[model samples]
Target: MRTLDHAACARAIFESIGGGENLVSAAHCATRLRLVVADAPKVDQKRLESLPGVMGVFCAGGQLQIILGTGTVNRVYEEFIKLSGLPGAPAAQKCTAPVLPLPQRLVKTLGDVFVPILPAIVAAGLLTGILDALGRALPAVAAADWFSFLKMVSGTAFVSLPVLVALSSARVFGGNLFLGGVVGLCMVHPTLLNAWSVGTAENVPVWHLLCFNVKQVGYQGHVIPVIIAVWLMSRLERWFRSRVPAALDLFVTPLCTVLITTFVTFTILGPCFSFAENCMIGLARQLSTVGHGIGALVMGALYPVTVVCGLHHMYNVIEAGLLSAGSLNIWMPIASAANFAQCGACLAVAFKTRDPKNKTVAIPSALSAALGITEPAIFGVNLRYVRPFVCAMVGGAVGAWFGTVTGIGATAYGVTGLPGFLIVGGYILPYAELLALSGGVAFAATWLFWQDVPAQDKTPG
Candidate 1:
């Protein structure tokens, strides 16, 4: 069968889905294209799935995802973003939809909170890794004054994590910044810590001062509990205002929510957060027992299909699980390499294609994929080229095997793209050399495997 015109195929997709006007909002998660439409009745899912550059179409989390190859997805996403004006300018918008549902909304909110601060997190992780490396390479550096300064710089983010989470959550929840900051301060308040520490001491306090154990530690950089606290606070504040006379409403609401929510945060929410953290950590430990080979194979094989379902973010919980445990695990490294492999496959197609537009889409996808961003690569390249995607998966399996055998694991929690190295530094020893070798091998395998595929057999959208 003759291949479809790539750009025309995208336009047809837009038109068939009731055009850009039907779009209420759009976003992309780790893999799938998420879109919310004004009228689902007009969407032709079967037709969209058949379109050139489309891999599949389905609904999840109340959004429609048009799965494209890693090669062309980004271009199509960009085109769609321009057609629908989102937060970033037409040219700059990367994701396609907005947050939906309670859990998804919370995830989106946390993502927004963390994304802006990711650079700082990465820098801190890198510095910490470098310090660890320096300690290993030049033991004397640890004794030097500069090393202390480096430690301070790297540790500041984590130590004051609640402050950051509060600031970001305030913006997301549209609450009082000062109150949120105050709440954040309470989480890390020295008095609270001391009281908790002393209470939990082996010599228990003569009388349990409070019904709840004060010794539980607060998660400094966490979002879930704090956001939930603030959301409940907002509701309480509103309720308080309704009951109080108009003259005292403003003062009463703030005072009430702050006091009530603060108590809840410390006594209930704080413990809940710690429990969730432990649960995630426990899950990671369970996954670790499976051995890296089986773990990577299962994760890598399901990676593409997960992308199709927009459930890839669910895998990120595994990374977070590893982070809470203060160790590295098997998921991110393998998944990241697989994504880059998709990029390499896309690049091959871009080079082989005679069409200027397809070439245009493929090149950027190649770059984005290499840098650790794969939306562009997947949507732009691999999804369009079926054989290339399959080859990319093969490459992913190979990379996963390498990671499993070598015990490659991410050291930190960050996006898995090229920047993943800094994250790798968080848990693994000899991070720098290991990262270079692992990343290089994955890239090489992807290029070598997909570069020879015949362009004529590439799949139509």
Candidate 2:
């Protein structure tokens, strides 16, 4: 084959596949370009994979991924979007389906909306874990003297969670990013917090009885309500933008949207959140009652798959529930160990693989996994190397089983990566020997299972 013109090839591939015009949504994880197409029939996957810069093509998780080398993927994705059209250019069409039962649809929709934000949540969890570790090592850091700075690092996402959701939700809603963020801010702002706080106060005046106690305190990084609020806000914003007179549109539209959204958030969204939290707690308790060994086994076996489909955020809710209830539960520790187990497995694959391309991906995958970001490892190495992935799962299951048997629990809910060990300090101090033993077993299993694969078997030939 002749040498390929990288940019030209990317453009041709995207154009051939119906360009960004056919996209309902687009996102990327470690190794794949994920796109939701308006018409899957219009796409020519064979041609796309055959393009000069393209490596492969596949559809997974409802996304048609056109695999490109790491460096050029983002560039190609940006150019493709530009060529297709910006959001609301009339080229993009919404998918239609028969109405689903309310509960089932809500559950599925929540999964989709929260997937993209998982990275940020993982980052926040990692930061919290590291800070917790540092505080334990040097108690002075946790004291009031250094409190503000530490809190800023740890609480940034939690406090400004609405903003993060707004950014992600903008892409999902096909609405203005800034406007969406503003709506999110309103949900989590001091005013709402103050109102809720006052209503719940012990000695509040009788006049306040007219105001409902929203009971929800922080909306930062909250999933269900903010997503619902943003979706509504986006629809309302789009409608008003189209119908309102241009002359008075700016002031009138925002004013009305804000007022309506604020009311909805306080009255409907906040209560919904409270109910969801209660449900999640109930579910967690139920899972815990089923014996930790069974719970851990399930988590270990399915954690990687959960991550692959971007459903891992669902687990974060469980962790958050544990935190809200004042102690860590069964999930986070297993999740953390499973992530590390994948890293160890990937590292073993890196050593076993002679393919330079696979080697390039494996090294970074290992590093990121250790740092608490395992997508690179999971996608780049483990998933690709079937044996390694299975090995990691087995390792995770073993680790989780050990932890559960020994009553291992996290003190906080966050990412389960290496840095997360800090969150285990006081909670598992007496059980350090057990924790170490479990980790050792996981590592050993990963190494044993991944070590002997031949170099020729590394890449998909």
Candidate 3:
């Protein structure tokens, strides 16, 4: 990236994508340069990828996104606006990405909301893993006062997820942050019976609203309900602020927002969306159990596709739910397979390529993949030779099949490929087996099927 001029990269993108005439809007989200273009078909994807500092390019949900990695996207985005000089598109309010269809938007929104909260979740997960490992070695360590404190530390995220979601989702939907926390707290109030306990108890307390018997349940580990609740709350808060006189706004806004949000969440949103959340969770769990190895194979194969579409982070929600429910995140091993397979595919390309320039790119890309970042390998090397990319997916599926049969999982959400060993949760033997097999299969497949690389591709810039 040091060799890549930010302005040059921006110009390359703008010129390749039909310049300001084509860009409907532009925005940056962490890594990707998210843009809404007039016509996706007009974009020259190869020229864009061929440019320095560019990682990958894909059109998904009607957005032409350039994956430029973190720390660099901001510079590129800034240069883009400065060069293009597009008008009336304020960075904050202007549509950055496409207005996706409702279902995709909903999933994307939920994933976006959870991403900010993942650091806490990951820390909690790792803490639990550490405690579990330590407890086995020293039984008395588990009973210590410090250990009790540590248990509370790790449990806080799962126990109070609503507040976390509320805090993040409120910001996402343009609501007052503190008020969102208030709404979240109302759902998980100390007086209320926990949401998890609702299923076990008979004849639980309820508040009737319309046709729905809204149970007085604490939303301890729920995600969707809190998000929907906060979104509604944000809208209500803004509406009140708009109608109320300026002098009374300070008092009137928070009061109406809290009252309406609390009543609506527990009564309507919580009870209703909880069912949907449960159904989603049940589906995920069902996938694991349906045909055992079949689930792992499917998840593994499709995992890379999600990465390609820039939607892989969505799995964090599902993984968090699985960890919160019990001991393991069964889906982690499937991801492990996908990641290691990419590494092997890239390495095979490095070994097979006759060109010095191709080898220069392929070797480092493979090493980067081994370290848990696959963008360089996927976009820079394996993807150039389409056969290797396809081989990697097949290898991922094969490896995950082994993982499901042996039942391995990871403790943390992010962390895979070779670094996956650090977070491997349930069993070591099976996890190692999965990695070994996934890499081996992908490497073999690439070597066997990807025997020919175009001469022109060998002289890559």
Candidate 4:
């Protein structure tokens, strides 16, 4: 293999997208160079794909993603930023790509808000799982001082999750992160009843000011309400900044923003949105159990479709709600089933395809999918072939039904596929069974139904 020319690759990408003037922002995540261009039509995508080190190119979530693989993409991103003269990690800006539908935009926003905080959640989740497993395997260890220390460290992220969400949402919505954090802290303050314990607390405290009664409740393990509150805060801060005098703006804007936002949030936004969020979570739990797991089955099958449309991140809100309410994240199992099923379908394609390129791409993409990143398999092999995608969907549906019926759940969120075993706690056997069932179904279906298409007959769109 030839050494990848990072600078040359960056230059090629910059030039192909019509140089710095056409680019609005440039960023990279694990594998792809995510770019927001001034005009979508001006992007010479073919030239980009043909560039050395460029593996694939596509548009999703209102941005053009150049699949440059791991390590390589970040290096190229650094060089690309230099050449384009763009700042690293700027505030979220509007993508000028062909206008996406409202749902797509909203999904993109949620993804932006949540993606930054996933590492924290994943770290905490994995640690929480490990601690739970240790406690179960060695009950006495749960009483150990070191074990207690580890537990506290692991619990901080989940307990302060609203703060994390608020900070990220503020950035995405273009607000001060610190102020946003303050809003988050206010919602989860010690004066209120912990949202998780609201059901069991015998005497729920209420605050009576002038005319109305407000429940002193903390918003823990919640996503939507925190997001709404921060978004309101961001808008208000910006509004106040424009009107407030520069001499007083520094103190006045933040004070007013926090005071007004928290006051309304506590009085109205918290109650109404938290209720709505709860209803949504309740509906999700009901669906997971309804009609003997029919809802889980359908959701599992359709989950990948939402992923393809960039709407799957919305599930993060639901999962966060479930976890916050002291319920297990049952949604993770369904997601894992769906993701692993795709891996199975892709692997089948790898073994069956005679085309050298198809075989090469399918094998690694399948492995990536198995490890919990399915974009490579879904876009590069399964969806491209069409048949395998459907097969995987069928597999996902069956596996999700089994997982739901068996009551498989994870201790946390943001993990799936094989690594899901870590966070599954006592559900290890059932989770493994779910993966096997889903993967087996998908593999068998794809092997029996899908035929290799000639390279010239198909191309990624």
Candidate 5:
């Protein structure tokens, strides 16, 4: 295989997106170069996709995302930044793309706040799964010093997830990350009772402030409250900075922001949002168990629809709530099923299609989907042909039912498909079966129902 020319690739991307003048700001994730351009219509998206080493291109949540895989995306991003004379760090860049509706904007904000921190969560989750497997398989080792050390390492992310969420939220909301971290830390302060222990704790400590009682409960394993608190902190900090005299701004802004936010958080945001989050968690749990996993079946089928709409990252909130409440991530299998089913559908397209171009795209896209990244397969192959997408959804629903009945769960989130094996613990066999069932069904269904339409005859969807 030929090595990618990072500088040339970046230059090509820069030109195709209408050069630096059209570029508003840029950032990159594990597998894609995310750009906010001055105008979406100015972008030569087709040219970008045709460029060497680019896997695919699409627009979602008011950003142009170009898929370039992992390490390659980073290198290309660095070169692109150099060419465009842009900052390497992502600042509070303003998007000029078409304004999204209120609900869509909220979903996009959740994606922005959560996407940056998913890597750490995914890493910790993988470790947690491995450690659990080790502890069960080697009971003696589970009691050793090394084992205890590993467990601590594995559990830190989930235990301190609030802090991580706050930091990311701060970045997204354009506030001081360190200050946001303080907000997160305050929520999980050692002095307060752990949120997870609230149900069992006989007597909970409370503070009487201004004719109201505030519970001294830590927000461990919670996501929404931390995000809201940090968002409020960001807004307050900005408001204070703008009005406070320059001489006193430095000291007064942070102090006022923290104190006021903390007061409102413990008294209002924490109680209100945590209650709402718990309700959502409860509802999700009920759905997973209702009518013999019928909820999972529905969710599994609908999961890809959310992805298409760029709303799937919101599931992270629910998954976090479940894990924080001391429950396994039962949601993982549904996602895995949905993703692998897409892989199966794409693979069938690759095998059945006579066109060399279709085969070339489908085979690698299917492999990518199998590894838990489905955008390439979904956008590049399956969705392009309507029948395959529907078939994959059916496969996902069936596989999800089977997985729910088997009762497989994961210790962490942000992983699915083959890499999921690392965190499924003892459910490895069941997960493999789940994959085979989902993929097999999708493959068979697509083979029977989907026809390879020749390029000249294919209609635009």
Candidate 6:
């Protein structure tokens, strides 16, 4: 026996999973070592679970995840990558399974695309919130000449969002990064009026295409069109690479691919997709107005499904638009409810579990969930038992209804659970009430209905 040394165990895991050659990418979230591998079936699940340090193993979101507590997973991950000899873990993380339905695959694709950029967006959102709160409290600063400079810190990321999305999307879609960047920049070109400013004018400048005229608006914070354009560009670039002669391929492929893609973007992709995007935004707004908080109830119940299905990143579009327009993100409260519900459920499991190892894992995971990181609780504790996860969702739905009826929202983009109080700020009272409604109900229900599964490792040696 290896006696569970982290490095030696990591090496065993690497080898058992068909070695570094089989690995397409490596990443971790909270408490799990997440891998997107070439052959998931080749990995020995029983052998992995039997490993001394590993707490659990499962596949979700097209990822092979090994749960090793948060602090422990980081150390093991560092060792695993060092042994694999990969360059600083795979930066291009796109999780997909041929076996999955198209909708699920799309969800994973969208999540992977935004994961790299979400942190910056979240930071910008927090900065914006802080400024908003400060400006209200201190009128002097709001009137200062340099207030715009302060706004820029938070405003720049959201305004130039397409560029950030472009950089990531090109890599994920296998297109030329430089060309993709150029396309994104073109969408937000200084010459074109900002997307938000379009409404202020009776009629903005128009571009005449073959059939119709476009509003000559910048994409600014839009999501879907930039993605569609990049996907088309990547496909075109690949097609050109195959046909063009090697001598001509270098220059011809780059120039011809980008030129064709750019032309199609202005004439077709941008305008059509922008309309579709606006319709979706309009639908979300309408849902907010739906009677008796029904939309909130449905969204709260389904929000956890997004996390499970890996579609949660799709909300980045809606949330960004809301914050940019000065309305706080309505989704944030639902997110808080869903996230804290998981924490409540996890804590319930911790209190009920008799096994020392299960107890050890559940306690910290609950803490992580309350702090606005829920995967540790979701994967390691609540979902493992099944019943608690359901209880959490029901609780979340109830909390969400309250939040919606009260019109509670958060100033920031990403923070959730207890820590969301920072962004909830003025909305804290109602937000905290929602958390209590969600978490208290979830914890009590889970505690009453759930029981711990006996751990084999807990048996006496």
Q: How many backbone overlaps does candidate 5 show?
A: 0
Highest lDDT, which number?
Answer: 5
Which residue ranges in model 5 land beyond 4 Å of their true spot? 14-25, 35-49, 86-93, 96-98
TM-score of each: 0.70, 0.67, 0.85, 0.92, 0.93, 0.87
Residue-wise C-alpha lDDT for candidate 2, range 395-449, written one tens digit per residue: 6776666666766666555446656666565545533443344445545665666
Instruction: Assess each prediction's global lDDT (C-alpha) against the native.
Output: 0.61, 0.63, 0.79, 0.87, 0.88, 0.80
Error of 4 at 111 (Å): 1.6
Lowest summed lDDT across 10 adjacent residues in model 5 is found at 89-98
Model 4 alpha-carbon drift over 4 Å, by segment: 1-5, 11-24, 37-53, 88-92, 459-461
TM-score of 2: 0.67
Give the residue spans of candidate 6 off by over 4 A.
Answer: 1-9, 12-31, 35-55, 61-63, 69-72, 84-97, 145-147, 249-251, 324-326, 453-461
Cα lDDT over the full model 3: 0.79
339-393: candidate 4 lDDT, tens digit per residue: 9999999999999988776676677788888998888788767887789999999
71 Cα displacement, candidate 2 (Å): 6.9
Model 4 C-alpha lDDT versus the unseen true structure = 0.87
- How many residue pairs clash in model 1? 33
RMSD of each: 6.7, 6.2, 3.8, 2.5, 2.4, 4.0
TM-score, structure 3 vs. true: 0.85
For model 1, the superposed segments whose C-alpha errors exceed 4 Å read 1-110, 193-213, 220-223, 241-246, 314-331, 352-354, 415-417, 422-461
User: lDDT per residue, candidate 5, 250-319, as tens digits?
Assistant: 8999999999999999999999999999898888888887999999999889999998987888888998
